[model samples]
Each structure stands twice: as structure tokens, then as C-alpha cells.
Target: MTPHYTESSLRQPRTPHIRMPPFTGKEGWETWRAQFEAIANRYGWDEEERLNQPRLEGAAAQFVFSQLSPMC
Candidate 1:
């Protein structure tokens, strides 16, 4: 005999999870371009701003490095 299964029991609710950027093809480039401006604005990381700023070294460099480090 086959085991019984209800529709509600068969369907599990999906939990939301963070996803990485699909950085490969045309779709990826479009996604990046769309998101990049917002991200850059949020972090004040525009190209001109970066170019105008003094090059950081020593402790300043370390601080910037730490800021850019990925969290586990």
C-alpha cells in the first residue's frame, strides 16, 4: 500500500535567503550596473570621489581593508 500524503503536508514553505550577484554574462552586467550606482551612493564610492581622495597607506589602508573585508 502507498503512504498517504496531504497537499498541505507535501508543500513546505520556503525560507528566504540572501543571494550572490550573478556576475557573468549580459544579465549579470545589467544587474551589476543597476545595483552598482545605489551601492556606490550608499558608501560614497564613486569613481571621481575615489580618484580625488588621497591614496591611503599604513593604518589608513588597514582600516579601509577591514571595511572591505567579507563577513563570515
Candidate 2:
């Protein structure tokens, strides 16, 4: 007998489609953080997934990278 495959059974996880708005600092940090959290919730990301970090761009990214670079 041959195996059966349904549409959903053949589907991959939805993680590939996640496209978060990068943190550009044009909006305030609070706003961006809220969006980030919302995205996490939408994707049902746990603490580990949250720690993976969303897209951080521009001056904010630069500052954070600089601060953390010492530990790298």
C-alpha cells in the first residue's frame, strides 16, 4: 500500500514567512518593542525564539553591536 499525504501534512512550518519590521528608531523604542512582542506572539515563539532577536538596523543596531562587541 502507498502512504497518504494531506496538504497540511506536506506543509513546512510558517517560520520562513516571518518578516518583522526592522528597528530603525524612526518610531520610538517602546513602539518597536511592542511590535516585536506582538510578532513573537503571532508566531508563538517561546523565550528561546525571542532571544534569536528580530531585525535591528541603523544607529540603534550599531549602538547595540558596539556595546556587545566587547564580549564577543
Candidate 3:
């Protein structure tokens, strides 16, 4: 026997598009942008830094590697 679908099951829920919190004003935006740049620069790596690394061989290693990679 086959089960029948209800209206609730037939429709997917809508997800609201959330806007990121706006910068309060120009000064606030500049401050935030500077902070972000500092953090990114602290973590960013050059290609040469990556090339010397050993190859990852497992899922866990790959996950950690991804977290360190800029692509994340």
C-alpha cells in the first residue's frame, strides 16, 4: 500500500534571506573592516608556505588542512 502526501509534506518551508548586520556608519565600517583585515592577515598563508607541507592522507587530516587553507 502507498501512503498519501499531505499539504504540509508537499510544500517546502521558505528560508528568509538574512541581511548581515550593517555597519553603524563610515567610521564603524572602517573599524570593522580594519579588524577583519588584521584577522585575515594573521591567518593568511602564501603558496610557498603550503607547498612545503606534507600530504594529508585521511578525512580528519583533510578537515584540519581545510580549516588552515584560505579557501575556507
Candidate 4:
């Protein structure tokens, strides 16, 4: 006889729907990073290192954020 599966074990994890929020011009990276840091803090994430990481400079940040946000 087959064993019955419990609801918790049978359920699949939900995928989050990532939204691409608006970036604020040239200062957008700073703004985005600040907002992201705030959210990370709220969730008890490691905000310090994340914000301090060496990121791609200037327009590269914009390009990367746009590409990654949709997949988040």
C-alpha cells in the first residue's frame, strides 16, 4: 500500500514575483541601494556587507540592476 503524503511535504515552495521599481536618474544606484538596504534590515539580512560591496561603476550599475531586478 502507498503511504499518504502530508500537505506540508507535498506543497511546493512559492516563487516571489519580482517587480522592477523605478530608478531615480544618475543618483538611482544610491537610491536603489538605500531602499534595498532598508528592506534587508527589516528582514534581518546582512545589510552592512551587501551595501559595502564594490559594485560596477556608473551606467554599469543601471544596466545590472535592470537585468537582475526582473529575475529577483
Best by lDDT: 2
Expressed as tens digits, the lDDT of each residue in 1-72 for candidate 1 is 999999997753232232334333334445555675555455555576433333345554566667787553
State each model's CA lDDT, in order.
0.50, 0.78, 0.46, 0.55
Error of 3 at 18 (Å): 21
Report the C-alpha displacement of residue 64, candidate 3, in angstroms.
Answer: 32
* Cα lDDT tens digits for candidate 3, 11-64: 532322322333334335467556644543454534543233223345545655
Model 2, 1-72: lDDT tens digits are 999999987765546677778887677999889988898888888786777667778887888887776654
Model 2 segments more than 4 A misplaced = 1-16, 69-72
Q: Highest TM-score among the candidates is held by which one?
A: 2
Reference-based TM-score, model 2: 0.64
Per-residue alpha-carbon lDDT of model 4 for 16-36, expressed as tens digits?
332334444556577777876
Q: Tell me each candidate's TM-score.
A: 0.30, 0.64, 0.26, 0.32
Off by over 4 Å in 4: 1-27, 47-72
Candidate 1 lDDT score relative to the true structure: 0.50
Model 3: runs farther than 4 Å from truth?
A: 1-27, 45-72
